[model samples]
Target: MSPKRPIKPGASNTSPDTPFNLPDVGPPALHRLPLNIAPQGEGRIPVDHLRTPVQSPPSHHAPLEIVDLPAETHITSVVVHAPIEHFFLAPNQLSRLPAPNALSGIRELGTQKHFVDLQEGGTVLLGIDSENHFRARLNSDSRPSGPRLERVEGTLTWRVKPSDESVGGSDSRLTLKRLRNPDDGPQEVVAPKRSSTSTGDGWSDPWKKWDSPPQQSSIDGIEVDGTRFLLLPRGTDPDHPIVYIKNPEHRVYDFDYMERILGTDLMQQPRGAIRVPPANQWEVDPNLPFQYPLKQYIATYFPLLSDTSLNKVARHQFGLANDGDMATDVGLTRLRQTFNDWKRGNSTPHPPLADPLLMLPTLATSISGSGLSRTLELPTLTPEGSLQRLDFDLTRQEWDYFKTTHSGADLKRLMASILNRQGYDVFTPTPSHYSPALVFRRKNHSFVFFISLHRVSKGRTIHQPLNSGPDAADARLNTQVGYPALQEMLQAHAENRLVWLKGGSQVHNSQSDSIFIVRDNDSRLGTLANL
Candidate 1:
């Protein structure tokens, strides 16, 4: 016999005359559970044995506050706005840039932009708009600069997926913790590609190479700026993986302009300066003094370091030296350390720590180093390109080993143990009452969990669409309807109830598009508390 359908309040199923009624949960709660559906009494009809209609709650008992949702809530829609401008400084060019002053009405600009001096301090301008437009003197520096103004507008649409699609053959291996439908359509996979590969000649942003080899079939894209741009999977491609221009009418030169606007002298420098060269080749060094750190380097030299790429000069010129003794490089090390401190919220804006470019590599290195494991084992399907089948049973010893390795150290030891025994990966963003998450990702799908610590009422709410963009509509529907339905299903399964509990959720709003699962009820209290 076919499995009986689960009842969801207020949800309109496709089947005609379906007996289920959409439950009137309560008011619009952001990031919290919306329903107050009580547990069925002992005399209540078993879902499968049901014959009578499900009764609706009275007009009262609605919640006053929003209940937070499980960490696994998948956000479906997101909107991102990027302001990019680009320009090429010729023998003669002059223009003013948007002035930024944080002390007064000019606060932080959303995702700041920079004015790059392509040449060595060769650019010049004498004006900026503060509370009012005023003449400002450009600082003298070793790097070249030029006067130029370039503008471009665009929007970016992106999605994150599990595994590097290109590296993990279609039929890779998967360490299954949950059973899901096999034919649930093609799962989105992230195809990893090496962005900057030096072919012994020079550094290559493969995505930019006109004749770049296609690393993976899955790495694809649509024409947005009148050109076909391939989207490489994150962690594998350039730091900014999802890139495209909204206006195709503008020439590709605009992309160059945008590139100049986004590129910071701090991030890009002559490759030779950063790495040591072979015996046969000439080292690309501009021989600039003390290689002023990125902040001071950009400020003094290419004061417009935040703007664009400098000359294709030498190694020392760019301060990208590989002397292997950064430990003693006072100028370089100090700049890197200052930036690291700022990114970690350890310190405020100090005189020398204004620009982040100076300390970026160190900051990123720190984040990468903060993890518990030296190597993380991601589940694969088959070594070849094909869908993988579960060979190991949940009770088997192999499954236990897989669990302990993947589950990191956290407060929920019992849950961690159970999860390991079950062959699942568990994690939480922030662990506390006000914190809204306890997620799980298995076989590339996400699941989110929400719990009410207090039987009387304490809990969090899940907001819909999960974004604060202009495009989101009636925030209540996405958060209220979508989240509760999925959460209720996952919560039911965690209680050991036998019912259909499918895949996981995606968090649309995070620096890294994180995969998650729902975990409800604090495991510390041995028994399942009253819902």
Candidate 2:
């Protein structure tokens, strides 16, 4: 094409011979583009643009911001049955309890490191006085070592008072107060105390009451104060005493405050309880399935295998022995029957079998040289190697001897062990004597067994000559006591009065009067009672 002249701004390069005269029109506002001058020897081309930079509409939602509040301390209390003098004045004894300094992840104060700075009628530790309303102190000893380290000091205050629950009023209540604050030390402030008359008639004597204080003492320390304090009572020995410990600074960080102060593990765990070993640490072989014999299962579930007597018996009974030689044959048969009954539609009337495993060697007939038969006699022997008749019944003397030696607890333990082997979760609740019920739970099924040993009456009628038979004796005993006992257990289970057996089926002795098992079934009672 021939060379064309450059068009000026706002001018159009159109021929005058065009069919129609058209007006010049600038770029639409929506498609407007900014102009910039090009440098010499540089050329720029104009491109049609439609999108323009527009600010996004302000968001209707606000940005989330989290603000942490300062940690606040609280006062907690526990009552223990122990002598107040032994708990507070005896430094060696108090050191054995759980203290804040002994907690993990916190600095450990050495043994005998804390001293009882006894204030008038109160105790002070780490600059916190017991007489004040303060409950905690930021422990300085636990503070990390650094220039920016926050010097946190944890202080504990304790008071000793008489306890009426103690035998002959010998036990005392040791009220403990824990405090935590950013201040350098505990502040002295007067806390209002409830008058003896205002509290209650039972609490009129401040020293006798476990909760109320006798009087308010003048506190001399910092000016800041806390609203709550943990009061712990010392009534009995450390083994069975009640103690409470909690972290008031739970909002900021989680920790056991009492464990740190007492320098002992105060977590309420079962006696002889063992932590489950890691999966890798277990002796289970990868090639074999995780299954064990009944005896081994019991030993694994309970920590009783450590006992020398029980360990030997368990090994002999179930380890390498065949099924027929197992000592728990009677218990196993009963358990199997119960399971089978449950599987079937049988609701009740499933009485356990008699002692089928108990057998004695009898004399056999011998043949003479010609064909004449001769009677052979062999000495009768008992399971314990005693020279007694196989069918010999327990005499009054023997029964008395056994009763004097064996305890109800032994029976409870035996029943629990048997139930545990059957895959039942067992729990022994506190104040067990009141209910004396053992709980067994599995899946959605739960039951309670109230075990009691009834003394056999010599005058009771025995239809079967088998004096050693548990069934005959149990039947006679049941007629006298078993039914009544069953009724009581049913009532307790129905009322939910028993703590451990609450909300579960009641099981009574299906066969033996000495042992009662309750299955968790509400409708089965009528059937059971009729049976």
Candidate 3:
């Protein structure tokens, strides 16, 4: 006998209608177990014998999918009652319509022909016919949408009706068409040249130089060198071009060049002597001069002695000179005491008082002895029949040194000295400010100047006011902290007074400074005058 086998449901070994059965087992009496006795009336089952069923989460919704559509061409139309002249006057208004981009938007490409080219995104060519109708065609095979097309044709019809009693001007209807593929024409067409000029063709012919360099040939009376004409635009349009001649060659001319050319004086003064107004005057009140000892000092010092003479006097009094070695100590002591007393506004102890050599009477006598009389006389030409040439070689060297070595304060002093010598009353505020460093008054006219010295970089040698932060644009002197000074200067200028800004050299090693006179209409100091 074979080993006993277990049976499965619905197998060939078992009948389909037979009841499901378990395998052979031991007697029920042997498998039974005794339960523990609980207290009477309790209603609880054993927790270890119980089991819970497992559960799964609910299903989720699926995500969305995207789709793309093809681009479409758009067409728009408009109707208006306006004169043809009005449309011509403002042709730019037509470009405002919704259309493709243009190569050269609404520009006149031809002269007097009323022929204008309207390119559509570099792919279509449109032109205005003689009847004022718009004709358009695809200049290339490419289309904005779908596959490459063979051709495209479109028309913009402008139907106009004459003005009547009802309408103020002409009535016109403008109809535009949507671009579409055409069936009859060839593909890959080239755009027609919009302009007949060589420039309009996008490039020039290499052989065209034989015709006198194009547009310049039309210019009459002026001879143009090849290089010069090539640099300029080739057209008759009135665009002003400025040509700068840098480092021009110096031309040598004979002494009689002017005489040979004109045979007479190029400039002649009037027969009568032109009398100029006096520059110098008693700036301080002559009657009340005693109040200003400083003014007295200036007057006494200027006319009596040169700077060299003053230096000599100082050296002698200080015992620094060889000649002063023989002087007595008591005499030197007395001289020093007298000078100190005079400076303190007290009378000198010496009988002669202030140096007799510095007295006005003695100065006048010395001037007479030098053959310069008190009487004023006009200057005449020298015995050589030519005006005496001023020797400026030494002056030029001194100027160079002064420019390089002097500080801003030194420049201010120099300017003040020059103005005072020219008979102008120069004044500086007690508390000095950077802007408007000096003021000058001559008769009724007054002027002010802002002085500056800035370093140059990158080979730029000219001082530009706007290049400095404090003097540029919104930070200009007029807008700076000391606006009152600028206002005063502007007011003086408005009243026909001179206003200037003195700019020192821009180079570190140079001393070429300038005085820029400000103009009335502009913020810029227009002209640069040499200092």
Candidate 4:
């Protein structure tokens, strides 16, 4: 039996079977403005009809839904709000928010569709994307250093609440539910939703679009840049190992980009943003079930990290033509998923290359190092493995708290703790309001991290220090690493106070290599060099 199509709840005359459309706002849909009034209605789909489908409906794509917001119709104008506290941070999941700055926009509660404003002037953006995680899932493969995939002795449920929650059926039902971050992070607890329901379950998907994601490399019509977003392999598409799709256009890469492909603005991804790097055919690793590369240029330029942010200038170079030519965005499941699809029309399968390094030189069969040589250990480099590495640093509780915190001081302290654990002799000097700083010594090297943390968790920007100098005492940063508010970082040789403050343990300024550590609020860290 086919599943029932959902329609917005509306007037008594509206049929439950008929799908509903939102009343059109002015020009292209900006999704920025908040609805002054919500349409009140009820949806009653018979349970038997919903249960008719034998395969799992992938409604909502598990947290992040793959929706292409057209240029003219997508980006919305939203008022940026400060970080709201995660309820778990409160004594008993009870949180108190300060006075409302302003109601920004309606946000979907259960899915990753919430548009956020990290600051007063921040604009929310969207685009189309694809991911490829060419993973080797052979059960026989094992790594003693890697985490074992076994059941744990604990469970955590948590979620982030956009101020004006867009209605969702799944979250609206449960009074107390265990929830998790979209990625493999900690979980938290939340109250029942305003869109109340008694029928939703762990298996339920109000936005069921697919039961399981396709295994094939999905080519998207577009991509975005200037923002970062993580893409974990969701599912597979074995039927079409290589595919070219002008997949729903306007696929935004960041979980946010362009002023035109941006919010409240009617436009496609900006043409002047950035350009993609050149592609090399040998990058594809065909030894696996799917087509992907063991060592590729795509991952090199992008850097193996926690996001799928593509720059607008970087598109159209990967064998793509037409407006949606570079279809590397819809990739799911592996490295090949993202770029292999982009190379589709021009890419072909090649046999695995066999090369070996005999450490024993193959002279003596019974040599002690006879079996020392091993094939490239590629599992650790897999996309799945790359994302899992982040799970090591945080729990559901800590990660959620980090997101909602407005205290730069909190970030400084957290940074201190993390470094201390990593064998750094951390000395915590009092942190300032905007320009918080931390100093530590590892071995002979002593350094200061002119640190800037996101004012809000995972917001696009980190809070840089004021442009004022030490001459302006009060406005100057307490621990002057020496950068204006606009300057990215203060170098090691640029006036050394931190090391001297550490009981006169100052080393040569250049030897310190005082660095800039920035937390993007996305559970990822970055550095700024002073070259």
User: Candidate 2: lDDT of 15?
Assistant: 35
* Residue 135 in model 4: lDDT: 15
Clashing pairs in 3: none
In candidate 1, stretches whose alpha carbon ends up further than 4 angstroms from where it belongs are 1-525, 529-531
The candidate, 1 or 3, that scores higher on lDDT is 3
Write model 3 residue lDDT over 1-531, tens digit each, in one string. 101111111112223343222211110000001111111111211111101011123223122222221233121122221111111211222243343224423233243222222111111224443444443222221211101112223422222222122322323222222122244244333222211111100011111121234554453212222222112111222232211111011111122231121112111100001111252211110011011111122223223233333333333332321123322223323433443343343444442223312211110111233332221111221223322111111246545765675355555555455445434455553233343255454432233333332322224322233223322533344433234555555566566544433322232224332221111212243312100
Question: By TM-score, who's the top model here?
Answer: 4
lDDT of each: 0.24, 0.25, 0.26, 0.25
Runs off by more than 4 Å, candidate 3: 1-406, 429-437, 444-460, 465-487, 493-498, 501-522, 525-531
Q: Total backbone clashes of model 4?
A: 61
Error of 3 at 300 (Å): 20
The alpha-carbon lDDT assigned to residue 88 of candidate 1 equals: 22
Q: What would the per-residue lDDT of candidate 4 be over residues 1-531, giving only the tens digit for each residue? A: 101111111122233442322221111112211111111212211121122212243343223222333333322222221111100011111112222123433222334332222121111211112222111111122311111111112311111222343433333322323344468377454443434433322112211211223432252211222222122212233242232211123343322322222232111221111122232111111111111112222222222112211221122122221123222222312233323332332221210110000000111112123333211100121223111111013345655665566576776666666555433455554646455555454432233333333332121122222222334542343343333321322344254312211100111223321111221221011122112
Deviation from native of the Cα of residue 197 in model 2, angstroms = 30
Candidate order, lDDT descending: 3, 4, 2, 1
Give the higher-lDDT candidate: 2 or 3.
3
Q: CA shift at 322, candidate 4, in angstroms?
A: 40
lDDT of 1 by residue, 1-531 (tens): 101111110112123443222111111110101112223321111111111112234333322221343344332211111101101212112223333233221212244323322111222222243323222122331111211122111211111112122322232222111122345454333222232211211111111222212452234443322334332222222332122211122222221332232232211211111112232221122221121223222222222221212221111222332122221223232333333332232442332133221222210011124332121111222223221111111234533443344232222333334434333444432333221223333322223333211111111122211123324422321232244443543464475431211112122332211121222223222212311
**Model 2's lDDT to the true fold?**
0.25
Error of 4 at 119 (Å): 56
